[model samples]
Target: MLISMNTCSEISVVDCKETAEKLNNAKRYSTIIIVGRIAIEYIGRAVSYAPEGDRIVLLKPDGSLLVHESSKVEPLNWQPPKSISLFSCIENRLKVKSYRTNPHEELLIDFIKVDFIKICNIVTSKLLIMGKESDIVKLIVLNPSSILNASIVVGTDISTPYGKIDILLKDEKENLIIVEVKNEKAGISAILQLKRYLEYYASRGLSVRGVIVAPSLTDEAMAMIIREGIVYIGIDQLINGIKDIYRDIYSYTKFKT
Candidate 1:
C-alpha cells in the first residue's frame, strides 16, 4: 500500500487486504470512498449484477453502501443506512458485504483492483427539509391506516369536475373517502372546497366521507367544518416526521467534537 505522506485522508495506492482491514473498523471513519475497478452483486429483494468496471464506492459509518458508475449523479446500487457491513480480504481481493435483517437483503461489492481510497470521520448538522402537502400525502398514501382510519388508499389526485381530490380512500367500514390536504393552516375556503366535493358526490347518489388535513384550523373554518360535517385532521405527524428525519441523519455515527 502506498499512503499519502502529508494527509491521513488519502490513500494514493492501496493493497486490498490492508484497505479492507481499515474499512472494517466502522467507528474510526464516518465515511469511506473507494475509487477502483470492481464488480457488484446484490441479492435479497431481487438479484442484480454489474460486471467488472471502473466505479466509485461509498460506505457510511451507519452501514449504508452506495456504488456509482462513471456518469450518473445517483448511485447505481445503494443500501439504506444502519444495515450491517462486513468486509474481508478474499483471494487477494477486497470484498464488502452489507445486509439488513428485517428485509434479509445483501449487497456485495468486490474490489478487483483498488486505485484510491478516502477514509475520514465527518461531522455536520442534520438535514432539514421543507416539505409540501404532496410529501405528507405520499407517506399517507403508502400507509393509509396511519393517517386515516382507512383500509386502503384507492387513488390520489383523482379527477372530478370540481378540483382534483388530493386522496381517495376506503375506510374499514368500506366507506369511500374524499381527502383534501393543506400544507398550512386550514381556512374557510378549504372547508368550502371539501364541502363542494362532498356535495358533488352526494348529488351522484353516493355516500362518501369528507376530510380536510392541515396543521391548524381557523375559528371560522372549524365552525364551517362542524356545520358541513367534514372531519379535520391535525398534521402533528408531519411536523414530527421532519424532526425524525433530522435526528436519523446520523443516528449511528455520533460525533465527539
Candidate 2:
C-alpha cells in the first residue's frame, strides 16, 4: 500500500545492514532522513572530505540529496534534483552515495552510528503567486479609469514592431497613454520599451503619453523615467483598488454541512 503524504515512521538505533536495506527499499517513492555521526567525501571537479561529525542526511524521491550539520541554512553538501542515490553497508557502517551523470559527480557519507531514521511520503503541489504582471493588466482592464486617472482603455496587447504593448489608454485631456506593466521593480528596459511605444505613436502624428505600472522602480530606472517624462503607478495603489473589486469575494464563506 502507498503511504499517505506527510506520514512518517521513526526507527531507533538500527545496525548498518538493516538501515541500508530499509533506506534502499523506500528510495523510489519516499523521503528518507537519517541522523547520525558521519564522515563525508565528495569527488567531482574538486575533491573534499569532512571528518566524523554528527549530521543529517536527506534523500528525496525527486532525486535530491543533502547533508546538513548543525550550522547555517546552507547544507554542508548537496545534490540537486535528478541525482541518483543508492544505499549499502560497508564493514560496520552504512554508506549512502548519490551521483549525477552529466558531470559525473559523487557524494559519499559513511554513517558510523545512526541516532534515528525517518521515512516520509513526499507531497508536492504547484506554487501560486498573486499580483503578477498579468494580474496588473487584468486589474486595469476590469477598471479602465484606474490607471493614470485615464477615462477609458483604448486596448491591451496592441501589436508593434518591437513587441506587444501591454495596455493603451486615453487620459481626461483626450491624449493617448502607453502603459507597460511590471509585477516587480521597474527597470531601465521598461522605460525604453515605453519610450519606443511613445515614439511609435509619435511618428504616426499621435499625441501619446507613456506610463509605467509596477510595484517599485530601481534608482537608474527612476532617474531615466524622470528624464524621459514618464509616469509611474505603484502596485500599492493598484492593490487598494483591487481590494475593492474583490470585496464581495472576500465576504464569501465556504458552506459547512
Best by lDDT: 2
The number of residue pairs in model 2 that clash at the backbone is 0
Tens-place lDDT per residue, model 1, 38-114, is 99998997999999999998887777788988787889999998888888988878888889988899898888888
Candidate 2's residue-wise lDDT over 33-77, tens digit each?
998899999999899999999999999999999898888999999
Which candidate number would show the highest TM-score if scored against the true structure? 2
- Against the reference, the lDDT scores of all candidates come to 0.79, 0.84
Indicate the residue-level lDDT of 141 in model 2. 82
Ten-residue region with minimum lDDT total, candidate 1: 1-10
Q: Model 1: which residue pairs collide?
A: none
